[model samples]
Target: MIPVKILTSEEAERLGLKKPTKKSGFGIKGVGCVVQGKHGGEGKLMEEIILRENGDLELVFMDPEREKELKSRRQFTGYLKQFTKIPEGLK
Candidate 1:
């Protein structure tokens, strides 16, 4: 599965998802079924996601198109000094 960038509230609205509502009770918003758009999607499907209380969004990857179109920032997590000698002047 390819990584997709998380969308902001405003971004989601702009992308066609409904705006957040106070009355919308939530454990996980996008659940149960894969949101599919027929007619106008041009064969593309709408990916589902969960909106967390802290505004964290989780995308459920059911379709494979995301792998071809999505791009994520590459992050190096391992400690650099463990792999090489520490450089001087910046310590």
Candidate 2:
């Protein structure tokens, strides 16, 4: 499982994730699942799995700076790696 990093308010601002935004219907919504947790502790370590509207599962991360660094080091092949596909029963 991928490790999770919960960004602090400062980190969120640095990553541009705290910017104000207008509502848009084209935005995709997903169900977030916590893959790990500690008893009686703030959720500092956990992976978030998002089941998107298109029936694709995604591991969520908040490090846009790291993503940009990685992208600059290599070419992004315009392909998304799907961890799980929707079940036939759900279709």
Candidate 3:
């Protein structure tokens, strides 16, 4: 399973990610998780996985450089599983 890092609201804010909100399709009123992958010798931000109020998962990709490198959305997503941790519940 793909690994992920769950962020606290404060940490999310510190990272400059969009604030979790009930109104947003991606998140509820809680924090989201970060999905990182290896790139160019170090870990790079791949996407943010947010839990919707209805229990659906939302994926938000924030790295433009990785986007350019991968070209297609399918390739980008496939690459994310290469390095990361999946939370227990998600697993």
**Residue by residue across 1-91, what tens digits does model 1's lDDT show?**
9998899888888987874676355455433224445676555553444555544454443354432333232222222222222223212
Residue 88 in model 1: lDDT = 36
Candidate 2, run of 10 with poorest lDDT: 75-84
Which runs in model 3 stand beyond 4 Å of their true positions?
1-42, 72-91
For candidate 2, write residues 1-91 as lDDT tens digits.
9898999998998898885544333244765543333698665423345665555576554234433544586732221244453333222
| Error in Å for residue 39 of model 1 | 7.4
Off by over 4 Å in 2: 1-27, 35-38, 62-91
TM-score of each: 0.29, 0.29, 0.30
Q: Which residue pairs does candidate 2 place in steric collision?
A: none
Tens-digit lDDT string for candidate 3 (2-69): 79999997888889796556556633644455456656566656556655566655444445664556
Ranking by TM-score: 3, 2, 1
